[model samples]
Target: MLDANLKAQLQTYLQKVTQPFEIVASLDNSAKSTELKSLLEEIASLSDKITLKLDGKDERKPSFALNRIGENMGVVFAGIPMGHEFTSLVLALLQVGGHPSKLAQEMIEQIQGLDGRYEFETYFSLSCQNCPDVVQALNLMAVLNPNIRHVAIDGALFQEEVEQRQVMSVPMVFLNGEMFGQGRMGVEEIVARLDTGSADRAAEKMNEQAPFEVLVVGGGPAGSAAAIYSARKGIRTGVAAERFGGQVMDTLSIENFISVKETEGPKLARAMEEHVREYGVDIMNLQRASKLIPAAEQGGLHTVEFESGGKLQAKTVILATGARWREMNVPGEQEYRTKGVAYCPHCDGPLFKGKRVAVIGGGNSGVEAAIDLAGIVAEVTLIEFDTRLRADEVLQKKLNSLANVKVIKNALTTEVKGDGSKVTALVYKDRATEELHTIELEGIFVQIGLLPNSEWLKDTVALSNRGEIEIDARGATSVPGVFAAGDVTTVPYKQIIISMGDGAKASLSAFDHIIRNS
Candidate 1:
C-alpha cells in the first residue's frame, strides 16, 4: 500500500537489517486480516533477507510472530500493526536483524542481566501516538535478550481479553500478569521498575514521606525553577509533579527559549530535569496533587495530598501546575482523536510523514505546527478563525517562506471528518461568506489555545474565570504562605523563559516570607 517514495525509503532503511528474519502471520480470512496479510507480503518482498510465512488457522483475529529463522524469541504482535504501529513493526524487524537499539548502554545491560523470564503484554490502539515508543522499547529488549519476550496487542482486536483484564486505556502495559502503567512511559523508567521488581512503585507513587520547608507542585520549567530556587535557599525543598517538562514536552521546536538556538521537546525536557537533579530537591515523579489543606490552626505548615494517598507537609507551597492543549470541540474531533487528530505534533509527526495534514488555529503554536509539518508532509493547510494570523512576525514570515504550506484565515473549523479507522478530512466555514468547505487530508492538528491545569485547586486558591490561578506581582497568591507561578497562573504571554522567571520570583518571595516571619 506504500507509495513509490515510501517504498524506496523503506528499502533504504531495511538495507541495514543484517540478519535474516521471518514473519509468521497467524491470521484468519477476515477482512482486516486479509489487508494485513497483503501489507506483510509487500514488506517481506522489499528485502531478500526477509521472509513472510502465513498460517490461516489457529488464530485470535490477526496476530503475527517475529522470529529469527533458526531461533524462537517468542516475540509476537497481536494486532494488524498499521498506522503508527507500522513504524513499530519496522523497528522491531530491524532490531531483530542486528540493528542496534537507540536505548542507552546502561538500560540494555540491565535488561540483559535480568534474572527470571519476563513476559510483557502491552495493549494499544491504532491511533495512539505513544504506543509505538513503549512497544519498540520492549521489542528491542526482547530481540536483544532471550529471557525477555513481548507481545504488543491491539486493544480493539482483542476486546474480550482487554475487558477481562480491565484494560481501560491505550498503551496499558502488563508485566508478569500485573498492570505496569496506563500512559506513555520512557524506556529508562520501565527498566528501573523491572530492576526493582516492584510494580507497586511504578512511576505513580512516592513510597515514603519526608517533610519539607518548601513544596513545588508542578514539574515543568516553572516548577523546576521554583524547586531549584527553593532548594538553593538551603531549606528542605521537595517537588511533587505529575510529569516533568510540563507543556514544554508537547512543544516541537523551541527557537525563542533564550540561548537555545533550536531543540526538540524531549531533548529540552531531559536537560531541564537534569539541571534540577543537580540540586538537593526531593522530586516525586508521577505524583499529581489532589488536595490542599492547612496543616493546623497555627497555619505554619500545609499538606499537599496526592492522588496516590501520599502526602507531604511543607511550610510554604509554589503552585506551578502547567497548562494543557485546548480542544476544538468540533464534530468528529473526539471520535478520531488518535486516528487522525493529534495534539502533540512532535510526538506523532513522523507517523504522518508524506501525508497531507491540516492544522487548526493561526496562533504561534498553530503556525509553528504548520511550519514543522510542511517539511515532512506532502502539504500543510493552516486554518485560522481570526481574520489575521496571530503568530509572531518572524514565525509568520518563516511560515510564509514555505512553498508547501497554505494559510487560510477567517475560517471556523466546524468538524473533523475521518473514516472509522483514521482521519480523512476537515470541514470549515468561511467567516466572510459563511461558505462551508472541506479539505481532504490525512491528519488534523488542533492548537487553538491552552487551558490551565488548576481545576483541582478550586476553592483553595483564587482563580480567574479561565481557571488560571491569580497571583500578585511578586507571585504571591491570595492565600498566605502560598505562592503561584508559570502558565498555571495569571501570567501574560506564556513562554518558557517567562515561566522560569516567574518561578524564580515566586521562590524568592516564599523565602522572603520565611525569613521575615522567623
Candidate 2:
C-alpha cells in the first residue's frame, strides 16, 4: 500500500514526532481493511514512537483513531486515508505526537478556549481536493481541545450513513448528528460558527480601526493582487473578504494560468494569500459586505457595511467580490440541493459512483464534467441549452467518445425532480420540438457558468443589465473614488491572469485618484 518514495517522505515527516502515540484500528476481514492495516503497519515501521493496535471495537470497521499516549484525542478516520487525505493523516500523526501546528497563535488559543462539546463528523471523498482542509482543521481542533472530537468519514466507504443523512456533496459536516454546513470552510469560519460571540467581537474590533487608504472587497486573485499593489505603494491598505480565495477555492484544476505548468486551485490560492501577506495589508477574512455607502464628501471615507454589522471606512474601495456558480433556478432545484443537485463535479462526483447523473450546460465545464463522471458514474447525460456544445473541439470529441455519456443539445432544464429526500429525475424541454423530456438520474451537476457577486453594489454603483458593475478601462465605477475589477465588473474574460492584471490596474487607478483628490 505504501510506495518507496512516499515511505521515505513519511519517515522524514515522522522524525519530528516528539512524543509517543498509537494507532487504534477497528478492522474486519475486508479488502479495504487489509489495505488499511498494511498502510498503518508501514507508518508504524517508520517511527519507534508510533504503535499500532488492532484490538479496537468501533462500529465503523476499517476505521482508526490516532490517540496520544494514554489519551483519546477523539480523531478518527473511517477509511484508508489516501489520495487528498494522505496529508491529513500525516499531519494528524505529527500533531498527536506533540508536534506544533502552523496555525496562528491567536487561533490556537481560540480553539483551546472554545467551550462546550462539539462532535463533528465530516463526510468526504478521497478524490475531493477540498476535503483535506476541513478534515485537517477539525483534526487540529480536536488535538487542541478535548471537548471537540472529529471523525472524518469517507462517504464512499460509509455509503449507508451518507444515504441515511441525505448527503450528496463532499465535505458535508454534521455536528451532534445535525447538519452543520456543506462545501469549503476554513478554521476561522468553523470557529465563528461554534463561537457565536466571535462575530460581535470581530465587529467591535473593526469599528475601532482607522480608515484605510485602499480597502479591497473580496479576496480572490483580483483582491489579492490589488492589496499587494496598493501596499507596495506604502499606503494604509486593508482587505475585507467574505471568504478569501473566493471562486478560485472551488476550482479543481488550473492549467491555463500561464507560466506555471499545472496547479490546483486551493494550492494557488494559498500561494497568492502568502504573497499578499508578505506586504503590510491588513486582511480581514470571513467578512461579508452587505452594502456600499459612498463617502458624503469628495475626500471623505467610503463605508463598506458588513453582514455581521461591522463597518469599515476607506478612501477608495476596490470591488473584487468575484463570481459564484450560476444556479438553474428551476423548480425543486433548491429543495434538492445537496440532496442530489450539486455544482462541482470534482467535489461531489464521487458520491454518485455507479449512479446515473445529469450535467446541465454544454460548455467546457459541462463537457469536462461529463467526461470525468463517465469513469466513475454509471451514466452521464449532458444537457445543453444551446443548439450545440460550446466546449473546445478536443473536449467535445473526448466527451463524444465516452460510451457511458449521452449528449442532448438545445435542451432547457426546467425542473429538478426529487423524492423529498434525494433527486430522482430531471425535467428538460427540447427547444426545437417544444417537447418535455424527463431523465431519471440520481444526481444533477449544474455547470452553466458564473454570476457576478455584485448584488450589493446594484443600488450604489452603476450596474449593467446583467448585474455586473460597470467600469471603464481605468477600473473606475460610476461613483467617484470607487472602482471594480475581476468578474464582478463588466470584464470581457474572467481568467485568473486577467483578474490579477485588472486588480493591479484598479489599484494604480485608485492611487491616481487619491493623489489628485488629496
Candidate 3:
C-alpha cells in the first residue's frame, strides 16, 4: 500500500519518535476494518520501533489509536484517513509518537487551563480541503492534554453514522455528543470554544466582537488584501469570512497573476493569509456574513451581521465578497464534480488533455475555455444556450480559428454523464429544435457566468441588476461610508489580480472615509 518514496519518507519521519508508541486499531471485524487494517499493517511494518496493536472484535466502531503500551496519547482516528485529509494522519502520527509539543508555553498553558474533560468527535470527508485543518487542530489539542480526547471520523467510511448524526457538512465537530460547529477552525478558535463556560460561548463571543474603524467583509484575495491595507493604516481593522481563501482555494493552477510565473490556488491563498496575518488585522475567519445594516445617523457605525449570530460594527466597511461559478443543476453534475465536472478550465484543463471534453456556455469564458481546451484536449465541444455567442469578438474569432473546437449554439446542457468514477459524456438539448444530443467526452467544464456573493448586501447597498454591488472607481458605494470591491462589485474582468487591486483601493477608500468623518 505504501509506495517506495512514501514508505521511505514515513520511515524517516518515524525515526524521530523518541518514545515507544503503538498504532492501535480497535475494530469490530467489519468490511471497513479490512481496508484500515491493510494500511495500518503497512505503516507499522516500516518501523521496527513502532508497533501495531489490534483490538479486534470490539463492540465499538472502527478506530485508530496512537499511544504507548499503556498510556493513551489521546489522539484517535474514528475513520480511515485518505483524500485531502491523508496528510493530517501522517502529521498526527509523528506528533503523537514524538516528544513534547513545539507549541509556545502560552499556547500549552491555554490548552492546559481548560477545565473539564473534552471529548471531541470531528466528522470529515477525504475530498474536503478544509477538513484536515480542523482535524489537525483538534488532534493537537488532544495530544497536549490527557483530559482532551479527539476522534477524527472519516465521513466516507462511516456513512451510516454520519447520516444518523445528520452530518450535512464536512469538518462537523461534536463536543461531548453535542454538535460543536462546522467548517475550518484554528487551534486558538478551539481554545476559545473550550474557554467558553457554556455551549453558547461562540455566539457570545461573536456578539461581543469589538467595533472596528474599518471592516472588510469577505476573506478572498480581495478581502484579505483589503484587510492588510486597512490594518497597515494603523486603524482598528476587521475581516469576516466563511473561509479565508474563498474561490482561490478551489483553483488548482494559476499562471497569469503577474510576477509569479506559476502557482496553485491553495498555495497563493496561504501566501495571502500570511501577508494579512503580518498586519494587525482582526480576522474573524469561518464566520459567514448574513446581513448588512447601514449607519443610520451621522457618525453612527455600520453593523455587519454573520450567519452565526456574530456582529461587528465599523465606521467604514469594504465589501470584498467574491464570486462563484454558476453550476448547471443537472443529473450527475454534483456527483461527478471535482471528479470530472470542473468549473475552472485553468485548474482542471490539463487533466483532460488528449481526452474529449465539452465546454458549457459561450460567453467570453466559454469561448476562452474552448480555445484553451482545444490546444490540450483532443476534441472541444462548446455549447451555448443562446442562439449566438455572447463572448467578445476577439475570443470568438480565436475559438473559431481552432480546428478541433466546435461551437453549438441554442443548446442547453441537460446532464453530466459519469461512470461513478469519472465523467464519460455530456448530454445537451437543442433549444431551437428541441433535439436531445449526447456527446462522448471525458470532462465537462462549466464556464457559465460568475455569480457575486452579494445577496446579503443587495438591499443594504446599491446593487446592479446582475446582483453585483455597485461601486465607483474609488470603491465607494452609493451609500456613504460603505465601499465595495472584488468580483462582488461592478468591476470589469473579475481576475485575481484585478480583485487584489480593487481590495487595496477599497481599503484605502475606507481609510479616507474614516479620516473625513473624524
Candidate 4:
C-alpha cells in the first residue's frame, strides 16, 4: 500500500518543477501482482506534475524508459524501492528535482533555438574514468543545444560499432555523423563544427596537393624508423598511413625492445613520431595508400596514389606495412580486449605478475609467450586448438616444466564472460569430447598468427605466398627503387629491435639505389 504522506511529498516536489518529465513503470505482472499496480496508481494520482505510465505486459520497456529518463530529467520508482532499487529511485528524484533550476532553464532555452540535427557518438574504454566528465559535458551540450543529440557508447561493450567507426583512441567525438575531432577538445572546438561555411572552406584547403622524394608506407616501428632515417639522410621523406603505430599501438607494454627496458605502446609510438618529426619527415595522418605505380622509365621514381585524393612522387620507396593480429572470433572476446584480455604477452605480462592468466594458441609464439608469462603470472592455462604444440622441443619442455602452466590441447575458446568492465572468466569446449568448462582468470593472452598488411602492394611489388613483400637481404624489392623491411617483408623474425635494424638497413639501401640512378 502507498504511504499517503510520502505520496503527498512527491506530488509537492513535482508541482514545484516546471520542466517536462515522464515516469515509466515497467512491471512484471507475474511478480508485481495487481496490488502493487493499485498502489502505484494511487501515488501517480497524487500529482498532475508527474505522469506515471505503466506497462504490465513487458519489463524490458522500463529499461528503455530509464534510458529516456537519462536524456530528460525524470524519476522512475520501481516496486517498493528496496535496497538495490532505492538508490536508483533517490538519484532519479534528484534529477527530477533540478529540472526547474535557472541554469537548466537557460540551457533549455538555448536548446530550443537550434535548427539542425547534430548527432555525436563517442567511443571510450572502461579503463578511462575520465570519459564520464566528457560524456556529461556532451550531455549538457545536448541540453543547451536541442540540435545536438549525444550518445556515449562503451568502447568495450560495442566492438563492431567501434571497429566500424575506426576508433583507435579514446575521447573521440563524431559530429553530425562525421568524425569531428579526437582526444580532449574544449567546448568551443566542439561548437565550431556547426559552422558549415568554415567546414567547406577547410575542406577546400585540404583538397590542395603536394609531392615528396621518398614515400614510406605504414607507420609502425619499421615505417617510422625508415622515415626518420631517410629524413635524417637529407632526403625529402613522407609517410602515408591510415592510422599511426599499426599493431604495435595495441600493445600495453614493450619490454624486449632494446634500450627501452619498459615502455607502453602508445608512449613508444608518440616518441617515435616525435623523433621522426625532428628529422623533418612529413607525416600524413589518416591517409590510406590505394595504389602504387612504377615510373614508365627505367628510373627509380614511383608514383603513389592515396584514397584521400592525394598523390606523391618519390625516387625511392620503403614498404613497412606491418601485420595484423589474427582474432579468436569468440563471443565477448572482442568486448573484453584490453579489459582482462590482451594479445601481446610481452606487453602486458608484467602487469599480471602473481595473477592467474590464460594464453591461447599452440604455435612457437604462443608457447614462448606462455613460458615467459609463467615466470610472472601465478597460473597459466595454455589453450591450444591442435592436439600437439608446434613449438620447438626446448620451449615445450620449459613450458611443461613450469609448476603454474597447464596445457589444454584440442580445445577452443567458446565465450569470454565478464562484467561490463573486465573479463572475469572464459568458457572453453573440448574438440574431441564436446565438453565445456569455465576458468576464472585475471587475464587472457592471445598469441595467434599474424596477417601481413600487404594487400595494397600486390600489383606493385612481389609478395610471397605468406603475403609478405619479397625483399632481398639488403631490403631491396623486385622493383628497382622499391624496398621493404621488418615483419612486413620476407624477414623471418618480427621483433622491435629487429624492425629498427631493418629500417636502418633499408634506408641505406634505398639511398644507394637513388644515388646510383642519379
Candidate 5:
C-alpha cells in the first residue's frame, strides 16, 4: 500500500480525470493479490469518476485493466506497477479517464488514424529506468486508439513467461506474439515502425523545408544546448536525433552533474529537452543521421542525410552524437547478446536473480554493477584486464566487502561460451601465467567504457585515433562551418556538465563563423 505522502499525491493526480473509468482486477487469493487489491481500492477512493471491480476474467493473476466506459481501450498492467512504472500506472488512469495527453497534435492524430488492431505486450523490470518510456508510450497509444491494446508485464513477477520467451533483457516488446524489439523505444519510433510509409513521408517533408542556420545532429545535452543557443540568436535551428537524451538515457544515477546534488539520467534528459523546446528550435526525434555531407563552399549550406531517406541542409552543423557502451567483442558475444550478454546491470540484473553472473570490467561501472548484483544474484565474478581495480577507493572497498563477489585481476575475457539457447559459461585467460579458466554463469554484464558515436563522421571530419572528432578550443572542426561537441569530440572528461559547456561554445563558434562569412 502507498504511504500518506504518496496517497495525497495520487489524490491530486486523480482529480485531473474528466470522465468515468473502470479498474477491473483479475486476481486470485494470494498475498500479492491482496496487496494489489488494497492499492486499487485506495486509488478508487481518491476520485468520484473512478470505479473498481474485483471480479475479472483476465487469465493473468494479479493483473488489472483500465478501460474507458463502454469503450474497448485495452491497457493492462500484469503486476503491481510500482517503482519506475508507478508513473505509467498514473498516466494510464488519467488518459483512460479522458484527460488529454501532452503529445504533439500531429502525433496524436497519427495514432488516432491508425487502422489495424495491435496487441502489444512489453516485458519490463520495475527497477529498469528505460522500461517506463516504452510502457507509457504504448499505454498512450492504447488510450488514443481503441484498436490498439498494450499489456505491460513485470518480468520479475512473471518468471515463467520470461523463461518461456527467452527474454534476457528488460523492455523487450512483442507484437501479436512475435518479438518486435528489445530496447528503449519512444512513441515516435513505434509509430515509424508500425507505419511503413512514414519514412518516405518524412523524407519528402524534410526535402521541402528551408535550410537551417544551425542544424544540430544529436539530441543529448550537447546538441540541446547548441540548439537553444542558436535558436535564441533569432536564427533557424533544428535538431535531428535517433532518440533524444542519447546515452544519458541509459545511465541510471548521475551525481557528478554539478550544482544538482543528485538526479536520474532520464529526469535530467527531460529537463534539458524541455529547456531546448522553450526556444524556437525544431526537434525531429527518432531520426538517425547516416551520413554527414559538408558544404562544398565556405558559408554555404551543409547537407546531413538520414537513414529514413531524408536530407536536411543547414548553414552550420554541430555534431554531438555522443557515445554508447563498448561491447566485449569476444567470440559468441554477439550471438548471445540478448540471450545472456547485457550492457545495463540496472535494467537486466533482476532477470538473473539467484543465478551466477559475471561482470566484464574493473572500473567504476563494473565494480558498481557487481556490488549491486550481489544482493539479487547468487554470485558475481568481476574480471579485469588490469592488475588492480580502476574504480574509486571507496567503491573498490565496498566491492571487496561483498560476500558474493569475487574479483579476478590480470585476466582477459577470451570468449563467451553459450548453448544455442542461453549462456552456459564464460572463458577467460590469466595474463600472468597464460592459463585459461571458465566460469559457469547464467548471465554476463559488460561494463566496459563507451565508444564514440563518430563512425559516420570518420571520413568527413578530422578524428583522433580513437575515432573521436578532433576539435579546436573554439569547438570548430577542420571542415569550415562544421563543429563538434560532447562525447563524440576530443573533449577530455566526458561528463554532462562539460558537454553542455562544449555545446554552447560550439554554437557560439558556429555563429561567429556564420557572421564572419556573411
Candidate 6:
C-alpha cells in the first residue's frame, strides 16, 4: 500500500497533468479493497485532470479498455518492464503520448486529416526482444496518426487466435487487419503504405481466396526445396513470399552446407529458385500471404490468401520463412549495419581477418565465432550482457583457452560508433561498474540469438511457446494441408542442412497427401 506521503505526492503529480488522462484500473477485489480504492479517490479529487474507473469483478475483462484508450492520450503499463516485452510497452506509451515535434508538422497534419481506422497488429513471442524497434516504429506512426491503433498480441497468451490466423513467425505486422509486411520495414515505407490506403486493401483482399495442392509460403531454402520436390512429383505447387531469399540473403557464405562448402545465400537462393521455376512451380515474389483458411471439411483443400488482391488454393502448405538475427536495438546499430555491424559470423568474420572484432552474445554461436575469429583476427572481444556465458561448458572452456579472445561479462552495448559509410568502433556500458568503454573493431558480429519468422501463421498453424512453428516428424502441422520446415519450424537444430532436410521431408509428405486426395 502507498503511504500517505506517497499518496500526497501522487496527488500533486496528478494536479500537474493538464491533459485528460484516465486510470482504468483492472485490479482484482484484493487491490480494490486496499490501496486501489484509495488511489482512485486520490486521483478523482483532481476533477477533469484524471478519471479513475475501477473494475473489481473481472480484472481481465478490459477488452474495450484498449479501444477506449485508443481515443485518448497514451497508456502506461505498470510492471517489471523486463525482457523483450518492456520495449513494446515503452513504445505503446510513446504512442499514447502522441506525436512530438520530432516529426515534420506537415506530415503530422496530413496524418491527422486521415479519418479511416488503421489497426496494426504484431504477434511476437516473449523471447523476441529484437522486435522492439518494429513496435516502436508502429507506435510512432500511430501517435502521428490518431486514426491508427497499434496492438501487439503475445503469441503464448493467444495461442488459439494465432493458430487460427496462421501466424508462423514473430514480428509479423498486419495493417488494418491484413498483413502489410513481415520481418522489418522502415518508417517511410510503412507511412507510404498507410497513405496510399494499401494497408486496408490488403486485409479485404485476403478475405477471399481458394485452396491449392501445395502452398509454399516462403522463397528461401526450405520453401524452395519444398516447391521443387512437390513440383517434381507432379503436384500443383504455389510459392508466395514478400522476399525471394528470406534470411539466406543475409548470409555472406555457406561453408557448412553439404556439397556446397562456399556459396553466398543469394546464390543458393537463386539456384533453388531456378530449380523450382524449371519445374513449373507457380512463384509469386514481393507478395505476402496475409492469412490461411482451413477447409470446412476434413482433408479438404485450404485457402491461402495474399495481400496483393490475389489468392491461391492449396491442399498442403509449407512454411520455410526461416529466422532473423536478434538485433541489439541500440543507437546507431541500424545506420551501421553492413558498414561495421553484421549478424552472421560465417558471413562477415573473414572480412575482418587480421583485424580487431567484437562478438555480441555468449551463446554457442557467439563463442564459436569468437573462437573462430581468434585464429583469423588479431583480437577477438566477446561481450556477454549477462553475468555468465550461456554456451556449453566445452565451448566456454575453449573460449577461455583462446589467448586472443577476451571475455567481457555483464557488458551491454549502448551505441554503435561509425561514419556514414562504415563502422569504426562500438560503445558499451559495464553493468557492474556503471562505467562506459569503447572498443575499436573492424567488425561486430551480432550472434545474440535467432527469432523464428512465425507470427503471421499464428492463426493457421500451431506454434511452440518459443514462436517456432509446430510440426511432426513428417513436417505436418496440427492443421491438415499445412506443413512447416526450416528454422521457423519447431526443429531442434537450426542448421541450414537441417532446414533443407525438413523441407525435403515436408515436400514428400505434401506430395503424398496430394496423391491420396486425387
Give candidate 3's whole-model lDDT: 0.80
- Residue-wise lDDT of candidate 5 within 328-404, one digit each (tens)? 89999999998989999999999999999999999999999999999999999999999999999999999989999
TM-scores, all candidates, are 0.66, 0.98, 0.66, 0.54, 0.98, 0.51
TM-score of 1: 0.66
TM-score ranking, best first: 5, 2, 1, 3, 4, 6
Task: List the candidate 4 regions with Cα displacement exceeding 4 Å.
Answer: 1-210, 297-300, 328-359, 363-382, 389-406, 411-446
Worst 10 residues of 2 by lDDT: 292-301
Please rank every candidate by lDDT, starting with the best.
Answer: 2, 5, 1, 3, 6, 4
lDDT (0-100) at residue 356 of candidate 5? 97
lDDT of each: 0.82, 0.93, 0.80, 0.67, 0.92, 0.68
lDDT of 1 by residue, 300-394 (tens): 68888787667788888899999988899889988887667877665555556678999988987799889888887899999999999999999
- lDDT per residue for candidate 2 within 1-518, as digits (tens), equals 88899999999999999999999999999999999999999999999999999998999989999999889898999998898899999999999999999898999999999989999999999888888889999999999999999999999998888888888998999999999999888999999998889999999989889999999999999999999999999999999999888888888788998999899888999898889889967889999999999996434889999998899999999999999999999999999998999998888988998999999989988898999999999999999998889999999999989999999988899999988889999999999999999999999999999899988877789999988999999999999999989999899899999999999999999999999999
Candidate 3 per-residue lDDT over residues 212-280, each given as its tens digit: 898888889899889988888898888888778888876656899899999867678878988898886
Residue-wise C-alpha lDDT for candidate 4, range 308-336, written one tens digit per residue: 56666788888888888888888988887
lDDT of 2: 0.93
Evaluated at residue 199, the lDDT of candidate 6 is 50
- How far residue 329's Cα lies from its native spot in candidate 1, in Å, is 1.9
| After superposition, candidate 6 runs with Cα above 4 Å error | 1-211, 259-264, 297-301, 307-309, 329-341, 344-357, 368-380, 385-405, 410-444, 515-518
Candidate 3 residues lying further than 4 Å off, grouped into runs, are: 1-19, 24-65, 72-86, 98-200, 296-299, 329-409, 414-428, 436-447
